[model samples]
Each structure stands twice: as structure tokens, then as C-alpha cells.
Target: MSASVTPGEPGIFERMFPIRERGSTVRTEVLGGVATFLTMSYILVVNPAILSQAGLPFGAVVVATALAAAVATAAMGLLSTYPFALASGLGINAVVAFDIILGRQVPWEVGMACVVIEGLIAVALVLAGLREAVVRAVPTSMKLAIGVGIGLFICFVGLRDGGIVVNNPATGVGLGDLTAGPPLIALAGIFVATAMTVRGIRGSILAGIATSTVLGLVFGVLDGPDAVADWPGSDQFSTIGDALDPDNLADALTWALVPVIFALFMTDFFDTIGTAVSLGRAGKLDDAQGELPEMRRVLLVDSGAAVLGGAAGASSVTTYVESGAGVSEGARTGLASLVTAGLFLLAIPFVPLITVIGQSVPYVGDTTVVPAIAPALVMVGFLMTRLVQAIDWGDVQDAVPAFLIIAGIPLTFSIAAGIGLGVLGHVVAMTAAGRARQVHPIMWVLVPMFLAFFAEDWLSVNVF
Candidate 1:
């Protein structure tokens, strides 16, 4: 009877996911999900560590992180049928906690309320198709360049976070001592993973991270877990955003808050776009228009995740580029994301294992080092770099912007700025070459918006 059933029905997992067409199975997808989750699970602890600085309770943020990420990612799989997982975004969290809450003296409650507001706006834009329109208006070069820029930025983050890249007062950045234990292990993982990748092996990125982690444990670089689990108390749960009052919401409606909201929106918008483009290209999953299939739905889910995360007392959430880890592992369907989401929920009971293994940072004098996760990021960055060849490098108008995006992303340490600069370069270069008439009107509109972003930055530094 089961074999007699038709394939057109949606009830069957194989029918819905089309595992045969994707050359994937439940087993492969499950393994891929585990790999992807392992690569980015550091977010579980990192998000709390960052947000707690804003007076949010650490344990509560952990629960919130898992809750928000699990819900968003599960929705991604079931709604958009994408393998991507969503989580509290890195840059957006910094904007929320560091810039908005700490620097602007806005309480964490107000900042989260703004995040909810931003997400609502995003929902409107996506549902109205304006978000897709703006994305399509961007020049092809700019889109491809944004992908490359994010790839470079990921590598930069890996280097810095791994303690392989250090600061210098004389110039800007200097190399870390390769002789040190933490950095040396990172370098070793890099070499090992690069070799495995070159050999066309699967799961090289996750494998490298595991090998490095084992080494860290053996060398006493990574300490054991402090506890088996630390369940968040009532004070930790639902504490943030609980203080959001009518007065604070009204106060946040002032002109001063516009720039902050705009900045938050821009960063979230571009980071999600860049990550999507790069991941799509890597998987050969996007349409010829450089848009993912059912992308609007994906954005809707992403925006909704942000709102839910903020309301749940976590930071802004979005789709993760670390999904590439799963994609590379042959996860061609939503089942992979479902598996990853399940892991996130399951890991809640093993908080100690998570913190000790994936999120550990040992203090070496004044600096704290995370030796395991950084190498995985570096490996993933290396893998994502193959998207660069898709750019039209022969045209100087194209190449210049591409180069700016690729370089500026890492140098300026801002993904949104990198995308903006790339667009700016493309428009100016095209106009200078008397191709102004051929340029898209959207570029003209966007150029000014990007300028406004910079201008706002200037005014903040000089005027404010």
C-alpha cells in the first residue's frame, strides 16, 4: 500500500523534499545538519556574552538564543524549504547592545523594542516586494562583489577571533606570535582543513574543528566543563524587553532614533543579502536572476525571526552563512535544517558540554582566546571564496567595485559598508565612463541612501 501511493502528495518526506532529485538522503542531511550546527554553535554562548554586557541576564539570553534560533530555523525549513539556519546575528547584536544600549544609553528594553519595530518594518518591505525590487535593482557586479566581500570578512573574523590577527599601535594590524599554543593550533587546523578541502573530501571544515579541539583538550588549552547544565531561572527568562513601556516606546520615536533604526535596518538587510547570495552561489541553488527560489518567503521568515528573538529577550536574528557547512556536506533540502534545529533544542539540556566544548575561551593574561571555533570559520571562509569567479573581472567598472567590496569588508570591519562602497564604486565608475544612461535608477536612489549612512556616521562623530 505504501509503495502504491503516488509521489505527488506532500505527506511523504521524500516526496516533499525530493531527496532523489537533490541526490541526498535523510542520513546525509542529518549529518550535514550536525556539521553546520557544530560549526556555528558558538553563537549559543557568544550571543549571551555580548548581550549580558547590556545588563541582560546571561542564562536567560542562552535560553532565548536557543528558543529563537530553533523556531526561526525550523520555520526556514518548513516554509522556504531552504537548508539555511537562523540565529542571533553577530553585527546586529553589537549594534543592539554596544551602540544602541551602551553608547546611546538606551536601556536594553528599549533597544529590543526597536529591534521588534525594525523587524516589523522588514516584514512589510518583504511582503510588499520592495525588498526584492531593491535587490534586483543592484548591478550584477555589486551583487557578486557583496558575496566576495562577505567571504573575505568571514576570513578576517576567523583570523582575529582565532588570535592569529592582533592589533598594533604603529600601523593597524600585526601578526600574532605563531609560536603561541592557541594560534599555532589554529594554523595547524587551517593547514589540515585546506589540505582536506583540496583533496575534495567531505566534512573537512567540521573535521578540522574537531581535530583542533581534541588537540586543545590534550594540551590543556581547553578546560573541562564547569557544570553539566545551568538552567536559567525566572529572573533570567523574559526579563529583557519586559521593561519596555509606553513611555520608552514613545521616546524611541524621536528624530534621534531614526538614524539608529536606519543603521540597524541597513546592516541587517545587507548582511542577510550577502550571506544569501554567497551561500546560494556556492550551492548553485539561486536562479539566474541571482535570487534564491522562494527568497521573499525566506526574508519574511528572517524578519519574523528578528521580531520573535527580540520579544523572546535575545538579539536580532537572521539566516546564518554557516549553513554553507551543511550545503558542502551534501544537504540539498530542508530536512538538513530541520535536523539542525532539533540539535539546537536538544543541546539545551547539555549547556555545560556546549560551553566547554564549543564556546570555551581561556584567558591568557589580558587576552581571551577561542581556539576551536575560529579554525572552522576560517575553513568555511576559504570554501565560500570560490564565488569570486562569478564576477565579471574584465570590466574595470566592475572590477573596481568588486575589489573595493572584497577589500573594504575586511578592512573597514563592516559588511554593510562593504556592500555600500561596492555599489558606490560601481555607480561612479559607470557614470564616469559615460554609461550613466545605462545605469539602473535603483542605483541612483541607493547611492544617496548609502551616502546618508556615511553622512550620519560623520555627524555622529563630529556633531553629536
Candidate 2:
């Protein structure tokens, strides 16, 4: 079918092909498509890098993970009827790759097993009706904090992925050397792309990536036999089993595997829920009960993706809030995901092209770029930007909770922890001022849970 025909209402094709619907005719679609493409282009190169770091073959992780994300995301749109796209989650990848794989030193197979287990847990939670209850248990302010925090976190991740930020021993953390090599070239490309995006250039993100990649090659940032391999060819179907040996499997299961399984499930569940709630607000997909239905579908798709990601030899799968960037560009249905999937599938033939691009990009140099902290920083900035609407600057009691909520996220590196602390601070402030009656009973329940969560983490660290 062609575009939907109702006036002011987008057509089916428009709904299906979200990027194309931003404006009325082909021109609008092209603009939206470019924007959509730019926003997502990073995944094409970044996902493979992250997954390969976790010990999967680059070829297998890229092709299989992309295909798995496509299938699960399409199912989300087709079944739940939401306009969300799914991909290997942002934070969860680090957790899987670093904590599970490197820290625990688990085999990729065991990491995949953990993903599958986590996915099953998520599915079970949704079926048990815990999804809504858990979300409701969180306060509105806290939820908003999480949303903004994660957004900033994602942006930070993008900067890192683009090689704009690197660690420094002398300054603790500072800008990379931009003038020395590919990092400089990459930074230049990002700036150009960002400028183009600001100037309303469609596909600025894609352009930035492409420009940086080309510059990387020209500057000798990436060169080797691996760099020149053909795109799709027979290499694309390589699997996890290729790198995994039978001898390592037994040892990996005994030590590394168990911890990874636990970490992946717990981290993905919390991260998925947080991102879902956050992005749902951005998309404005509130349920009849005033909650975001997208949150529920997020749980489902994320969980399913985790399971499939395991089979496909990737880490824990979760929803991509980056999709919200696409939504902001006017994607309102699964069609956006289908398009994303289609793009991934098509890229198979150009695998070498993407590899080259990844190698060519440069890292960001200098502290001016901002610390590689979580998205909480951006969320705080966003909240402060609208502080007048959400809170009164004159009231210390009301403002303290918000302050703690914002500061606590990055300070602790846990959004839920920050929220929990904020709630406790709110409760204490109200009680001390003789306003204890104003506190909701439901809020009381969270205090204990928060305490337990922290206590567990503490005990694990101390004892284990």
C-alpha cells in the first residue's frame, strides 16, 4: 500500500516508513530518512566493535546481532503496535563486555547464555504483571531524572564511540590528542557533521561518520590486512563457536559464567526499564492509565532480543533509546525499525566498507569535551532548563530532592540509587518540617527496597 490518505493523519506507508512522513511528499521522506539514517549510523560500526571486544568474532557479532535486533524489533511493532526500534542496548553492552567478559573473564558462549536467561526473566516479569507495578513504584521526578540521565549517558557513549573522549592518567580523565592523529580527524568530522545537523542538513550523523572514516584512512589511522577484507562475502556468517574452544568452555562455566549470567540479567532488566520509561515520555505514548505503554513493549522486545542475542552470539539485547532521535524526526510506528533492519541487512554486502569506516575515525582530545560520565549530566541540564515549570527556586525543601536526584546519578553511577537517595532525602526533609503526612505510603516502600539493593551490592563487594 502507498501512503495513508487522511488529511493531517499520516498514511499507512507514512506510518510504516516514518522517516518519509516528516513532510508531505517525497522531499519530506528524504529529509526524514537522512536524519533517521544519521542518528542510527553509529550502530553499524560501533555494535561490532563492542561485541568483538566481548570475544565474539567481528563478522558474526555484526551480522547476527543486526539480524536479531531487526527480527525482535519488527515483532515488537507488529505485535505491541508501538513505534520503537530495538538494538543491542548501550549500557548493557559495556556491562556484558567489560564486567561479564573481561572482569569475570567468561567465554562469549556463557555471556550469551546469560543474555538468554535474562531475556527469559524479563519475559516472565512482563507476563507476571510486574512491569507496570515496578514502574509505578518509581516516582515521577525520579523517572524523569532517569530519562534525562540515560539520554546524556547515550550521548556520552556516542562521543566515546566516535573517539572523541579518552582516559588520561595525569588529569584523571581528559581530552585525547586531537592534533596527533586519527582522533583529530575524527573530531573534525564530528564537528562538521554536528554543524551540518545544526544547519538542518539531513543525515548529518551519517555524514559525520562517513567524513571521519574517510579522513581516518587518509591519515593512516586504520591500516592492516583486517582493514581491507571484503564486506559481506563468506566472512559474514562466522559464529561464536569459531573463537570458543572446548577446553576453555569448562573453566569459563565454573567461574566466569555464573557471575556474568547474574550481572547481565540484572543490569539489562534495570537498564531496559529505565530507558523504556525515559523514551516513552519523549515519544508521548502514554497508556489509558496515563503510563507509557511503550515501556511494556520495551520490556517484551528487550527480553526477547536478549534471548535471541544469545543464540546469535551477542550480549544482552535491549531497546535503543537512540530510536527516540528517529521518533523526534517523526517516526511513529514499527516501520522505523523495519527500515533500520533493512539497512543492516543491506550493509552486509558492504561489511568491509563499515570496518574501514570504524578504523578511520579519530578520538576526541581535551577536557573541554566533557567527562565520559553517564547521561545523568544531560538529564540534569535538561531538568534545570525547565526548573521553573517543575519546581520553585525559592523553596529549599522542594528543591533539595531534585538536587540530590540530579547529583546522585553520576556520583554513584546508578540512576536507581540516585532516585532512592533522593526519595530518602525528600522523606527526611518533609518529616523534619512537620510535613510527614504529605508523604505517600507507596513512597515508604521504596526506602527499604533501596536500602536492600545497596546493602546487597555492598555485601557482594565486601564478601566476594
Candidate 3:
């Protein structure tokens, strides 16, 4: 049955979003949007918290995160007419922070410029009709492995951020003082979030972060915020437009960074395809060919969001898998995304509260601090790992590469390195198995590129 409308007259939302045609109501869409916002809102705190460690001001990142999410999510709704909401992706942001920015010793502006470059590439691929081709070129096992490996990597970071893991001179990494105030708060947060998730509670991750923040305050591990809300000004948005600077873009376009850009692009590309496909399936929105309606538009907006997010210094915004929450709440159209976008915009004034939630608290000593939002990271990492079972462990050719990715990412603390190793392992394993003919031509192309990427430092000095 079509959605009910006022007798003989459809409302504006009905005309704009075609709610009746999609078998949904404005009320339902609004509810689903709120559900999605709640489910993924943890990014408001977590994204800035992670980026701030890379020298971004927490307040500015907070503004950038909210504005980017609001704009991107709104565009998704209005342009694609889909319910998927966009935000700074967790794993991608981690790569920007730990690998691109810190590991490469580049300025944060340059790191963000990489996001813009990858996003523009993604846009070009979509427009040229090559996005789907690229997706098919990758082996299914490697794709699944990439997500699983990133999940483990994110979880490892969460553990460290929460003081659950500590550096040890003897063994590299060991357990931290769980009995300590900050660690205890984190433990309680993890437990609460886990239980809430198991109980099917909405916004459980955000709740977990809130719980930890409250505990930190009570235990004196965190200081209280001076205000609940503060109007943000132009000066507060210092991170905005940083990615668009010519110098940053030029720096990011160096010859040595080509592989890095490809790596980031691959992550952003595959992740959106996976999330959109899964959400479409769950919502029964896919057609006979299993393609969602307006899929091209969806991809365009999601890809462009990476550019917007990076320019705003919020990393690469992509379609959130948590949008499945909205889908589950019976959202079938972009109206839901519009609602989610509005909520994100409404959240901007509460930056002070978000800052407090993301604030770091002293841990082992004055030199050590633990994030209040670490539990959200831990929970999100667990959610991302659900794709692991999709890998065919029985096949040695696939398993070898999958294992390399799963183990290498966290162990090496480098997403790019892990992906490179996995791709190399896949090529070698397939050749060894006498099935080289079956490997995609693209995989072969990537092998030499990855080898060069791995040897970039040596080549820079010896050859370049």
C-alpha cells in the first residue's frame, strides 16, 4: 500500500522525496533518519579525537566533522535520493592520522589533500563508468580481507587509546593497568557498549562513549567542560579549506605518494560498494540485477563527500554502514538522509560537550593520556569484523593473502603496507598454484607498483 497522505492533497515532502511511491511516510523517514544519526553520531566525538592527535585542534575538527557530515549527508539525500548518511570514515581517518600524517612525517594539510585527490579520482572513475570495473578486478577474498584487516587495525588502536594496551621495552606491547582510573573507565565503557549492542540498543556506541566520559569525570580522569553549548564562529573553523591549498595538494601529489593515493582510493572505493550493496540488500531496494536505484548518483555523492570532508579537515567521508540502522527503521528514500543531515547540523552548537567527550585524560603519567571515546572505536571495530566469515579460508591461494592482510595491518600499524603485502602475496600464491591466468590483469599491474611503494625510500635515494 502507498503511504497515507492528507486527503486529496500530498504534502511538500511527498512531492520532493516521493514518499508515497516508496511506501514510506514523512514520519517514518524522520524516525529512520534520527535512528541513523543516533547510530553513527559517535563520529562527532571519535573523528576529531583521533585527528586531534595528529595536531588538528579538537574544536576545529569538531566543527569540520559536523559540517562535513551535515553537508555530505544532505547531498546524499537530496542528490541520490538514498537514505545512506556520510561521515568521516573510521579506518580511513586512522590511515590519515597514523600512516599518512604521522608515519610519513607530513603536515596534516598534506594528508588531507591526499583524501581530496583520492576523492576526485573516485569521482572520475564513477563518471567514466570504470568504478564497477575496478571493483570486479579485485578478488572477493582480498576485498573481504581488506575490511577485516582494517577492523583489526582499528581495534588495536582503540586498545592503545583506551590504555588497555601499553608499550613494553621487553615484549613490544603488554597489558596496561586495568585497575588504573582511566583504564577502568574504558573497561566499563567497553562492557556497557558490548552489552547494549547485544541487547539491540540503538546508539549503543555513542552511549558507550558517554558512559566512559561520565566515568572519567567521576574518577577524576577527565575534567568537566565549562559549558554545554557555544556558538561557533569563522575562526573556530580553521581546518576548513586546508585541503584545497595549492601547496598541500602539490606536496600530496609527489611521485612517491602515488601508491598511497591508490591505496586510499581502493579503501574508499571498495568500502562504499560493500556498504551500499549490503544496505540495499537489507532494505530490499536492489532490483533484479542487485543494483540499487540511482546507484550512480549515490556513488557520486559518496565520493564527493571525501573531497568535502578532507577540505573540512575531517578525513574522507563515505557512506556509513550504520545507515543500515535507518534502513531497518523503514527508511527507503533520501528524506531519511535529509533528516540525519539536519540532526548533524543541529549538533554543531554542542561542540563543547563533544569536545569533553573526546578529551584525553591522564593515564600512566602526565605524559600519557587516554581518550574518552575509545570504547566507540572498540565497538565499531568489532562491527567491522563481521565480514571476516565471508573469506574462504579453505582455499590456500586466497587464504594466504587474506591472512597477510588480517595479520599485517595491526602488526605493522600500516594499512597501506598491509594491503601491499596482501596484494603481493595473492599474486605470488596464484602463480605458485599455476592459476596465474585467472588473476585479474589489474592485480598484475599492482604488483610492481606495490614493490616500488615498498622500496620507495631506497629508490628515492638510489634511483630518483
Order of the predicted models by TM-score, top scorer first: 3, 1, 2
Candidate 3 versus the native: TM-score?
A: 0.97
The local lDDT score (0 to 100) that residue 232 gets in candidate 3 is 89
Report the Cα lDDT for residue 94, model 1: 61
- The segments of candidate 3 whose C-alpha lies over 4 angstroms from its true place after superposition are 1-6
Tell me how candidate 2 scores on lDDT: 0.57
How well is each residue in 1-464 modelled by candidate 1, as lDDT tens digits? 46765655444677668566767777888888897898778677667756766778666788788878888999998888778999998767766776568766787888887777788888999888798666567667666665566667667667765678877779898887777778877777777888888897765666667667778778877777777777655655665555356766666665455555655676577668777777878877888898788777888898898888778778788999889989998887888889899988886766565555454364445766666667666765665567789888898988998899788767776555666787788888989999989888867876777776657758778877
Candidate 1 lDDT (Cα, whole model)? 0.74
Candidate 1 worst ten-residue window by lDDT: 356-365
Of candidate 3, the 10-residue stretch with the lowest lDDT total is 362-371
TM-score of 2: 0.65
Error of 1 at 144 (Å): 2.2
Once fitted onto the true fold, the runs of candidate 2 whose alpha carbons sit more than 4 angstroms away are 1-38, 103-105, 147-167, 224-299, 319-337, 360-464
RMSD of each: 5.1, 7.4, 2.8
Off by over 4 Å in 1: 1-62, 80-85, 88-118, 235-296, 310-316, 319-339, 358-365, 457-464
lDDT of 2 by residue, 46-139 (tens): 6666666556667666677667666776776666555566667655665566555665556666556556666777789887877656556544
